[model samples]
Target: MDAPPTEAEVRDRLPAGAAPFAGRRTELAALATAAARTVPGRGRLVVLAGRPGSGRTSLAVQYARSVAADHPDGLLFARMSAPDGSPVPPGRAARRLLEQLDAVPAGLLPADPAAEDPACAALRTALAGRKLLVLLDEVREGAQLLPLLTEEPGCLVLATTAGPLTGIDAIDPVILGGLDQGAAVDLLGELIGGTRISCDPVGAADLAEACTSRPAALRLVAGRLRADARASVTDAAAELAPAVPAAAPQAPKSRGATKPRGRGPAADRRQARELLPAEPVPVADTDPLVAAFGLVYRSLPAPAARMLRMLTLAPTQTADLRTASALVGCPAPEAGTVLEKLAALELLEREPAAADGTERYRVPGRLYPRLVELRSEQDRPAEVELARARLLERLVRLVDSARLLLDRTAGGNPDPLPGPLRLRTPAQAAGWLAEERDQLLDAVRDAIGQGDLDGSAGRLVTALLRALPLTGAAAPADLYQLHELVLRVAERQQAPRRAAAALLNLGDLQAAEGHWPQAEEQYRAALDRARAAGDEPACARALEGTAGCHRALGDPVRAADWYGRALALRQSLGEPRAEARLLVRTAEAHTAQRRFDEAGREYRAAVAVLRRLGEEEAAAALSQALERLRRLVDGEGIVQVSE
Candidate 1:
């Protein structure tokens, strides 16, 4: 392992935002004091609890960068909430942090490593004795932070949450609120231009006040300002201010009211009227952020506004150009321009470019609910369903293309996939899979939720089973779940062939984990379904799976019987590659039973098929195994010549 990053390097590696981090000076001071008061051999945790758009994230990031020198081990950051505002499980967070540290090798982890105790153990081991600064952002609950917490005294954990975190001991809670007027103004100046604020100080102050001094709301206002330079601060302030109804004329107060200037009876009657507003403004329209968003949203070009609304239906909160294009049913370039506009207006956050140079954008947490509302009120149900269908189609095509590039099967060279989604090489395919794993899984759930429209969901699930390897992106547990989900969908759709394929997939995963009995059970079930459906290919695969399971359990006779059935099916199918593979497997079963003559015959038959198929590498490997077997038989002086 390399040495921990130096303080200077940590400073250099801090996350940089488009604008300078503003405000939260008092909050930063409290954090500094908490860090200074840390006891020896005991870590300190500070939870920055606040509502969304309160600048908790900015405060946490700012504090982390400021104290980078104190903790030289390194700085680690993980978001505990997923893009769709759901809590990320602690184990998933740990695995992610472990990946960041590069402390646990990927190959050493099992599929569904999150459920593995070893992952948390590896994380604890990696974090032990290190003076690291760990930032857990958007933590949903106190329990979610426990597994990720380290006992190392030298480290500090700074977490941000939307509400109070319970079930924690001796946690220092720092409440984050809106920024002060000065800081808000400065931030707004930085976003639009300092000259605009400098020209009209009072108007800028009113605008900041109108935003309630919230950073997120201020940024939205700034977006409006940037969009139209000719628009003045007074104009934005007036637009954001809720309209109040003119007060009704009041009758003169009775002279008798002088009896209760301080009495309870008159005061109670007066308070009732005060509680009701003269004008009942729509709560959504009264909200400054909502109003600001409305202003910006209304200003959008028709295509851009429609695209923004449709985005709320995306499988994930984050989207790339390809995803945006699919959602909007537009070409890529047009979608790119719309995305750039949204990012500019602070409606969407522009993430760093992907390895393939594809631009990505994420919806801000505060804005997502509002976007969903807009989508609901404006878009018809049929339009939303159509958009979802388009997205599902695009995802299926991309996954199929990726599967071809990985080429995990015996199928010969892959045919080229058309369009921008094509993955040209295995490395490229793997990278795309890893990067889009979350989106792909979410898309699967989305499709299943949509009732597997036209069986595309089933096709996608099967493709993923073949495309994603067990190593990095797709966990075994996840694959198993996908198989189960697809099986349910197929059974409900009365598609026996699809259900049999899913059963086979499930068996394969179980067999990989050494669960021979469970695997055989699944294979048997699949065999029954395949036979009922008259699906010969599925039946052959199910038989082959059962044979492998029996072979693994040391039952060579049973394994050989099952393999023979599969071999007959493969031969009848006239697929030379499939026949060769089945022959090799049968040879292994015969060898396990010490049937040397039978094994030799099977091996020779496999070599001839492979050679005829122009699979020289496979043929040579089998030939080498046959020669080794011959040498063993010669030593025993029991060699039998078999054709």
Candidate 2:
């Protein structure tokens, strides 16, 4: 019997990392149960269906992990896409599956990539006998994946997607409604703080209702208020009062026929409905979330309402009075006044900032998500596009400005980042990003989702990744999600240039996080894309990155292959300084693999390069390598050098 892929192996199988989403226990359970029928000779394909922010992708991932122990073969996940609204060919998804199975695919191998049938054949054949877990995340519909479903035993198929997979009636299908009342509250409790919930029962209850019990809504709301030390639960609840109602989705039309009424949890719902009302209320009459936001939007002064719509112009924490005013074509003072009103209404919060006079505001706790949802509802595609262009225009400028500041600073600067743009130190940069990083990322994501296909995501992602390394205060989950988002955005655009850069950055994160094989894959993918795009500089960077990954994996020979490429690329680009630095790194790899002669020559070359560049620090770095190589030749060894 062939060995099954381990959890580590299955994880590394993913081309890009996974984004972390909260609250989808019900959806996940449905997928797991559907997939549980896989036997030695018989298997089933289970489709997870939901709309945007419905938590389908998250559920499929969770189910795959939960059942990993039972099906040792491994898990393969893919996001399928095609031209127009046509289903992606099964062959394309199959190739992705094979790639995840540790099979180094030749290239983008899709013949009739618009057809699901042919694509599924390749995947079905690949799964002949070995146990495998396949997750088709975020597809157009179930029929697109129908061909990929295998009859072979020992294989589990998990298909998570947006909307009802109408044609998949023959198979098990579970529609994810909004989270239940109890679970939604529990999730909010976990995110917001048990103490706060306990102290202000009404506030907590109100917040839960305002969030519509949607996991994403609840988490978003909880995360916002958690930062306000002075925030009372009731105050926060009141802020989200428009969104406040109840946790559960309004009953399904079918369920309404059979289900009882007036048995819902009764608590301080009015206060909970304050924050967000952007997400569509599918059960408008029955859902408290709809009631909450409906009231908020209705009550707003027309100027404020118009301004609220215009806020699609602002990035999460970067929204200052000036930007708001400029975007809305109003004066700064006018915008400031409106901003305070939004805050008073619990629609925004001004975070504590340094001495810089610039102040920053976020959508009141989780209510901001509604703004995004609301933005998407414009009936006219032209209007939506127009709004997107305006928003991204402002974002492009903001990120460009931020990038200038990032480039000027080396490690530390005492003057401080001006205003609410608080990146004082590397650590502070990381902490600030970690704290508000999700909101920022969500803003960027909204930009892409609404089709901001220009190089805008590239710059925004650059700012994000640059900020990531410095933040030690963020959760691992948040860090990884950022990585996942960057990868997704780059890939979706099919812009290999951007993809390669994001891959290198993501590999750095993975390597740092102890995911070496995965890091190596990212590095290799980056190297391939860079070379293909004829981006010599990026190629060299990727090569160097791959070498570092190899060194971490204790594979000096492979490390040498990558480093040698980096050195050649640097040399070709006329960067003698960079060439020398890589040479020195190559020498260290040699020492690690116990190759003394080669190590010695590499060190000498590095020293020569450092002297030419007048890099005293780098020249000093070679001393330890010199000593180590000499010691190795004399039956001694190398010493660790500080960076």
TM-score per candidate = 0.73, 0.45
Candidate 1: which stretches are off by over 4 Å? 1-18, 33-44, 69-74, 103-122, 129-132, 152-156, 243-286, 400-430, 452-454, 462-467, 470-485, 515-643
User: Residues 188-232, candidate 1, lDDT per residue (tens digit)?
Assistant: 889989999888666676566566667777888798789898998
Tens-place lDDT per residue, model 2, 337-441, is 888777554455455442344456654423445565565563255654555565455544544444344455654333332243333444343344444454466
**Segments of candidate 2 deviating more than 4 angstroms:** 1-301, 308-329, 339-381, 395-436, 464-487, 565-575, 582-643
> In model 1, what lDDT does residue 456 have?
70
Worst 10-residue lDDT window for candidate 1 reads: 266-275
Q: Which residue pairs collide in model 1, if any?
A: none
TM-score of 2: 0.45
Measured on C-alpha atoms, candidate 2 has an lDDT of 0.60
